[model samples]
Target: MACISSDSSDLYDVLAGRPRLTGLALAPSDDRLIASVQVINGEGNAFVPGLWEVDPAGEWEARRVTRSLQGEYAPAFAPDGRLMFLSSRENTDPFTRTSSDSTGPGLWSLPEYGEAERIVHHPSGISAFTVAHGAGTVAYTASVLPGAADTAAHAEFREKRESAKITAVLYDSGPTRFGGADLGPAEPHTFVLRPDGTQADVGGQGVVGGGDLALSPDGTLVAYTRAVAGSDPDVNANVVVVADAATGEVRRIFSRPGHHYHRLVFTADGRSLVSQRQRELTYDTPWRVTLVAFDPASGAETDLLPDFDNWPWPGSPVVSPVPGDATVWFTGDERGHCPVFRRGPDGTVTRLTSSGAYSSLCVALDGTTLFALRSTIDSPPDVVRLDAAAPDQQPVTLWAPADPGPLPGTLTEVHTTADDGFPLRAWPVLPRDASAERPAPLVVLPHGGPQMSWSGWTFGFGPWPFAARGYAVLLPDPALSTGYGQRMQERGLGQYGGRPYRDIMMLADATQTRDDIDATRTGLAGHSYGGYIANRAATLTDRFKAIVTYGGQWNLESFQAETDLHAHARRIFGDPLTQRQRYETDSPHLDVRKAMTPMLVVHGGKDYRVPVGQALGLFNDLQRHEVPVKFLYFPDESHSVGAPNHVRILYETVLNFLDHHVLGQEWHRPQLL
Candidate 1:
């Protein structure tokens, strides 16, 4: 795999080899450089971590940062340019009675230019930490027990009984000691750092915690989101609160009864605060990004950008420190694709990059440079830098000295009408070499999250593999997809295998007419909710030539009964017994005898969510009925196949099966019991 720059204009491949860069962090300085690296082997078989420094000229230098630690991650540069990181020391004593002898998470610091040393060690767990902008003080949240024995006991209890209560403590940078002021028994919230080396909790009392806390440039006021308890499926979180750092007095500046306050930032002059709010929902709730301005003196709120769709799922909003300007930078979704956007004082939105497949973005201290992580289906993630001041400037790749494989085909937006005339959105990825004369086979790839929408991104299974192998892929985001609005997501409730199934079939029908798609050799694949769709599609229609399910549920009844998150399922679906008709109608087991498509069922043996028994039940039914079916079980894998070797084998096996059934091409067959 190779690294591809984010700027479409300067699209050039960098790095050429098997080792793929997996993680990246950019320095705060506007030097267009990255501070860390996570690499994966060429076959995507192994993951290795190291620290690196990449200069503006695209030069790379890497060194092993933590040799004594087993697993290290979440590295950040301190105010004084020192590297602060989290690492878990290897605990070989299987029978150790003390937490110190058992594995524990610790925080360590190293000169941004030197060797690493222990900073703070928590016998229980260190959840998070933040360094003051220029104060060189570190404020962190940690869960600690009374003693080593108690820590060990809590760990064992969490493993065996699945229940353990740990105390969360907030501490300022000081000499090593396990004691501090108790933040609370509840989850640790975001800590706002003050310039004077003091930190305050932004989250108040409640289960509906806080996220994305932003402090003003002068560090006078802090803005954060607060969710109200018992508000499910409602997009609007309760309120956006602003607190005075000096007095610790807080005021609720903005409130949306059912929508969530997603992101917050103060204006350039600190005269007003801007925040993004969206309606909250349990399943698929469509979200809209609205910007609100708050007055500091009177606690008055006003809408700055009422129609600002650019902040869809907006997060990490940062107001520039430069004077005489009121611009804010944030990342949000546009038409199902997430992109980084910079909003000018006049409310003009400038898209920073063409590629919408990005998880995070951060602006440098100068506020003129932007560092982002971008990825797509065929490409692994890499950090890239963009000059925010010059929108037309080219992007520079900062990690992974290789070219990403060819773009995983081309995705085109599609819409199909369900039985009720409701339009569903979908994306069809056509084969790279597809043409009217030599049409490719079709793969109907239903998305998981029957509640979550399939946002356009580079790759994560689905039709990407099939399309890469000369097949066309159709991905349908049925009524249950979020971001379309609350009404659309609520359509999935008590209607699984109903409207959602019809939506997928309609998408398949629309794809069959594509000049580069062959309807006769179509297939279906999905995981989780998608797995359920795959099984249901095979049983409901003979249009598919083959089907694959990854850790998918076969029987909704068994799923509700066996899943570890039974409480969540119960809340989402109500009482299963009362919704017996919906469960029966949705279960693939009910119509397994009707399944004619050659099916491959894959499951991780340790998956407790969609238990392996779900796959086993479907496989057993197919076997009893003499259906052409295969089952592959990974003993050490879980709901997700995390091991590199297992992942490679799984993909190979799936491709081989698809080749044989969908393309009528002979391929090596893996042994399936």
Candidate 2:
């Protein structure tokens, strides 16, 4: 809760220098919290995630536990109190890990107070794993070649393919790539690792894997979310499968026609599990996710807070660690506030955190103490303690590794009436010197998700760099963004660029009323879905002096057909072929001639979600129209441009672009370019 001086390093350096707290886990026996801290290595190309421990009660200072150059993630404690996590550090288990060094992630553990050891190694590596709450048994997912019986067979095939100099993957259907990563020749399957370090296949031979996984209290069962491919290869639904650990017997226990069930966790009774659900098969419409419970054996079902919509998280709901309390704690973004809400045994949901955004939640074994990485619009993530029994108490900060000096600027929220007769809200971050005489140039930033909202601010979102440079950044959450409740999000279903832009413009109009804001020199910027609006801003309105689009889609027709987000495209834009007129009208690439504003297009070449082609099309059209434009492309990046050097350059380039196009300052090229 304390800020330091920016004596040696400016706010941008502090913002870019902060290590990311990727995940957190609590030791079942004590209040020891292990956080996965990731930072770009010296090369600024690889992320190195290591384990760091903090005592929430402030019994000891935060300390690093593991130092893996390749990165360690998903920190969890074994029932015996040892810290277990997945790591890609150079594996010494030559028999299982064929790679000589720095191979894929394998299961590793550190004793309660001892050195790190390789507990489970697989040639294909592990994607996700969970240790039982009451036993040392661990369940995980690893990729395997299509017909391969297990990891051994998959390894054999891999060896044969390498020896034969063959490298080709034939995919029948489904997404072969994600954000900026590849899903290749092999498919993910489940496996279980015992305390003795022995491993075996889960669900026998046919079980294919998906994303997140959870285990039962006694370690007798494993619940995982798997994509059940349907008749159309591109059409798939998430089905939660519950499997017996001892016999490899698995059953498709939980699924719905229009819903996707994932992030499965078994309740204390072990008969039922709680997980998140997506209402539809679209891009972010699914993010309006709700909580669902099911009795795997009886097919009985329950949907928690059936009326409450807005999937506050991208994945997983934290159920109370108590043995018998039917309580689940989840966060939701409402208006400008993102708070943690607790669901009690009677299904009554109550807001816990009075304000600030909460993420990476961990509950103590006794269920009385709660720990999470909390943040506000101006402050970075810090360890905070929350009371499980008190719903209205303010979260108390416990630890912050990067606690430096005071923030160079301040952040505040405001709301206005939208043209739709509803409240529209935004967070306007202004520098310390912002005033009427030297009003800050406003940058209107629309959040992604289309379902996502700017409930709280983080430096990671590229705002601090601008704010430190004296620009006022306005992050607005239109009706479509999640956290605003289900009704608001549902209203944005078919109108991707329509109502959202109106909401953004209406908010911009409100900012004009502030004497400390230069509304005339205002710029428009967004990433992902927000990028889509930025592109639209170029074609639809000259209200913005300049526009910046980061990995935004341009051609909805092709976006619907070629992108991995076919479901999102199909849902938001409908069938491109049948709705040809709608596609033509909505696709900004088709109306590039209307654009008069100078623009900056940033994209990740490896971004599979919103491919670089989207940016390329927009950039090409602007070039043809003789519109002042610039493009910053990172081939090694994904939907989000990560990596330290890349991030530094991103901040520099964006600030420079605003200077050149909006502030009438000379543009200077970044050195990295």
Candidate 3:
């Protein structure tokens, strides 16, 4: 293998075609573990995620289970030793033939001694599902049109609208859009399938299945979060609900005015329900998440991690499978790492794993072993097994795809102190042989989410490829980044351009002090909130030689109104109409005249989160100011830009722009661009 910079095509291939393992499921009895492995299909053009059955305790062989063209995910094991998943593949159900245009994912089942078949078909699609541990009960969520009686009626409604060429939709309440998805003519509904082959609608007249659902071990109860519309339109508070799996009877067990609960799971004995309780965002306060255990009988709530400060990463908490066991396991982001944490029955939280981000956590049926996919900042995910009783021990690698080989560089950490005395840390990817005599140019890269942290492995906005191009990429988790304590997150609330920007600069300064990095030639790049930081940095200081912002927010005022999450944006940024001063002071567009560094603006036309107007606004501002700038637009892409070729073009254009600006080379356009 050669240095990635030697051939741009090679860099794209390695990053774009790398195999990924996600969505884990373990069988009830023996050592059968299932994972959704995403790899380049036989066509070698598109990456498809398919289910793989692995024997971790034996020879560690991974056998392909499903090979659908559209792919399969969310693997789970039914109590009857059957493999189930959600897929958008052509439904072959003879009873209800789905039209050719109906490509929504349906619940599929593959028995140990039988063939795979579609078990539950929905008109819109099944998004997520959970199965009972000891009983033959399965619960899934799907979209249903208002006033429709059942799946048949929903399908007919869709067909009539299509036949009439009517594309118009009306929404009386709630959000019209969330991220890349438009708010529905059909709301999400959760359905329960009993052991006797009868179906019941558990979620009625509310967005119940919009989040996550969990089925009890006995298959009698289903726990999930339901949306309760507030007095204001588009504003709703999520409350935890328990439903009768067989009778379709719903009961609202928990509700709070300003807090939301979701990611519900039941204890082994069905005595307690656990959920992630999140406080709603406000203009002055940052949203926070904490795990809570609720007593379903007495309606009492207990804070699981009352003393823990770090935020638990998004995933259902894995409760103990042994009956009467009250132990819970999860992972949280802290100091650039997402490590496993265990909260015992006594409410004591302990750090289980010292490194790697863990997800798809599952405890074996016998309660002796645990299985999860673990990955670090420098490696892809690998399926591993751990002793549930002694989880502090090292995990045994069960199955990992063929290594993508070694990187041209290695990962290292840097530390700094913020202006307010908060400790700041960053991960820097330095090229091989980067020394004082051969220093690599520094690229200050920040993670998005203003509230999200860069704690583990990620396919988006990677730092390794840049290191292959002889750049030291600095990934900083400044104020407002999660995984840190609530205080660290709230430090920069409602002030994107304030402490967060300053903390990024401080971390960048610390990285530049390293002997392996070049202090004089530095660049800045970010996506989403990170992009907002890049734009803010450009206006605040001329320290960086070049800047790149993707799906960035240039004008807070316009963004609060145009974003898909309008209410959310307004909650964080404040209302533009009444809080005019906040917008004027925080928006990067208001201070475009201060920017001197050359910038490359990137955006996706269909990106509803930040919207294309943001990129257009920034490009126009740079042009009006006569600053060196370039725009890369992807009309078909969205907020994350997952298309392989589109990703290639994104990095290709970014590298070209950086080489010309920071490296002081001729501005040669990329071949693909």
The lDDT per prediction is 0.62, 0.76, 0.81
Give per-residue CA lDDT, model 3, range 140-166, as digits (tens): 887888888987788899888889998
lDDT of 2 by residue, 1-673 (tens): 2463322125655665667776789988766788888776777565677888988787678998888567788888888888888887886555654442327788888886767788877776787888888878898887778778767677888888888998887867666665566667887777888767677787522223455777788888888777664333234455677888866787546666656666778886676788887766353453356788877778778888786654434336788777778898877776666788888989888888778878888888788888888877776678888898697788877778776457767888778987778777888888788999999899988888676778665545556667777788888888677666666766665667778888888888888789999888889888888899999888899888788898898988878776775665677676765666658767888888898899999998888888788888888889999999999989888888777677777777887888798889888887668
- Which stretch of 10 consecutive residues in model 3 shows the poorest summed lDDT? 228-237
Give the root-mean-square deviation of each candidate in angstroms.
8.0, 2.7, 2.2
Error of 3 at 292 (Å): 1.0
Q: Using Cα atoms with residue i matched to residue i, what is each candidate's TM-score against the true structure?
A: 0.73, 0.94, 0.95
After the best TM-score superposition of candidate 3, give how far the Cα of residue 52 lies from its true spot, in angstroms. Answer: 0.9
Identify the candidate with maximal lDDT. 3
Pitting candidate 2 against candidate 3, the one with the higher lDDT is 3
Between candidates 1 and 3, the TM-score winner: 3
